[model samples]
Target: MISGETTLDVRRRLPGVPAHVGIIMDGNGRWAAMRGLPRIEGHRRGLEALRGTVRAAIDFGLDYLTVYSFSMENWNRPIEEVADLMGLLKRFIRNDLGELHKSGVKVKVIGGRTDLKPDIRALLDEAEDLTRSNTRLTLIVAFNYGSRQEIAAAARALAEEVAAGRLKPSEINETLLSQRLDTAGVPDPDLIIRTSGEKRLSNFLMWQAAYSEFVFLPMHWPDFDRHAFETALAEFSARERRFGRVTAQGQNGKTKKI
Candidate 1:
């Protein structure tokens, strides 16, 4: 967590803060292996880090925070490991849902749910329904989510519309395709932070992150704290985003589009 010293810094206020931030929470297994502990322990610690991250986001006054919780490909892992992950997800929601709701944090789950067990699907629905009206921050849990799958599903939906003569192929623009995705209505992430030093999207927010700035931290997910979040934001604040255009300094020393 950020110390009291930096918590009140005026520089950390709005205007520069990212309105939406996405996180690729990685390195839990590796962290556990390094410490000669089971992977489950690492995942457990990662949950604690998640709580810290949520608090940090609230402290920073962020509007949205999305996390890569469980990827669809994770189902290919050993049965035991998969079971452990499922157990942890259930535990986290059952134990922490009330706290999140009381803090005015809304929960949104993104990904396909057709194959999920009845109980798990119900729990996910309950989480979203319970905190749908929260205002402080929106926490998106990308469970069973893979960017490629998400994009493909959107394309398939558009194709079906075209096939049914409900929409024309020429009308399938970027905006339309984005609206079909699960993240519709939510703004594209302004900054994406990936922990554990690995560089790559790893199938996270491929289409939505077209212009997002990335910050890679060497610390593992279980070690992510408020200070780490602050460091990423600091890096983000230093970079200039041009979004496919050039920014030139004008005669009056003001930034102007070229």
Candidate 2:
């Protein structure tokens, strides 16, 4: 928890809330391990984390919140665990879609859908359709997402475009490649936060997060409360986003830009 802070103070302290924030939710299995519970149970508790994240992001005035729900490599986990995760995802869609829709949270699953069960796919479609036009907030779930896979898919798309003579090979610039990504229309994340002390990207949003400010927290994903989110936002607000150029406030506001 932030020390000696009021809600009003926190709200007043924002230089500017980011338009987009990405999260790599880590340590669910470890969290469960610590409690002597099954890894799947850890993922269940992680859903609680998801609930907090959704509401907190909305409260923080973020336009988009993208969560790395499941990576492509996660398929290597035990089949029972995978089944449990899929089951939980299905349940969330069934039980929470109405509430999410009512709150104007647009749910989008951005990744390969080929390997998912038909029922899960149907739930995703239903959730997306129900909240398609929601403007309050957009929540993107990167299930079975891999940055390399995304890049490969983009390359394939480009190849097809070139083969059809719709685009010149030389015309495939950065923007063209970005447009082919799963997050095509969405703005790149201004801040990427990973909870439970991990420092690696673990193959999340590789191409899009070239300049994103990163925050790593020691708290487990299930333990990430609103205060943890506020702390992250506070940390972000303190930094000068110079992109590549040095800013007048330097990066952390302690040193002056020369």
Candidate 3:
């Protein structure tokens, strides 16, 4: 357990420890390829990394941890790989749900569900329902999620409301749109980390990441550990988040456009 003083010291040094953190778990296949092993091996090891990261998140006092588990684009992969991925998902939920709930971690899944198999959908719903009241941390799994599709769906819903004369077209705003998103009621991530040196968002949380701090790591997803997580948080702490306006230091010192 983290002592009070230790926690305070960490906070003092890493003041920017984000309340919500998002991760793009990339490089599984590449890692496996580099090792001359099947891609499934890398994915399997990545699952182990994820388990460790969840425990780390709870210890770090993070309120939300969002992971890009699967994407809408992932369906284009070989059918066998997809089946393996689905199997892993089922295995993780079946094996970890009870432990997660016991540790006060809530599981929240974001993404489209209409096309998912009934069993997969049921497992997701069961995870959420089982841990709805947990307060320690929320593990958001982005399965079959595409930022563009999410945005389009929200727009469609709002348009329907307008067509029904229940709302004005001009009444639409960022807040309204956000409420309709899969991540509705969740705080926007303050930091987004991508492994394997990837520097792009790749359609993950495109709209919600407008002001997020990004950390790209050269290590693959399977190698991500608590230390790596802390390193990213420390990097975030060292930077100033100005949002859109210049900081007071920036205003008084060398003026650089944001």
Quick one: best lDDT, which candidate?
A: 1
Residue 133, model 2: Cα distance from true site in angstroms: 1.1
lDDT of each: 0.94, 0.90, 0.93
Q: Following a full C-alpha superposition, what root-mean-square deviation does model 2 have from the true structure?
A: 4.6
Instruction: Estimate, for each residue in 121-173, the C-alpha lDDT of model 1 and write its tens digit.
Output: 99999999999999889999999999999999999999999999999999999
Question: Model 1 misses residue 18 by how many Å?
Answer: 0.1
Q: What would the per-residue lDDT of candidate 2 be over residues 192-241, giving only the tens digit for each residue?
A: 99999989899999999999999999988988889999899889888888
Better of 1 and 2 by lDDT: 1
TM-score of each candidate?
Answer: 0.95, 0.90, 0.92
List of clashing residue pairs for candidate 2 = none
lDDT of 3 by residue, 1-258 (tens): 255566534653455678999999999999999999999999999999999999899888788999999999999999999999999999999999999999999999999999999999999999999999998899999999999999999999999999999999889999999999999999999999999998999889999999999999999999999999999988987888888977444756875655
Model 1: ten consecutive residues of lowest lDDT: 5-14
Indicate whether candidate 1 or candidate 3 has the larger TM-score.
Answer: 1
Off by over 4 Å in 3: 1-14, 249-258
Q: What does the lDDT read for residue 174 in candidate 1?
A: 97
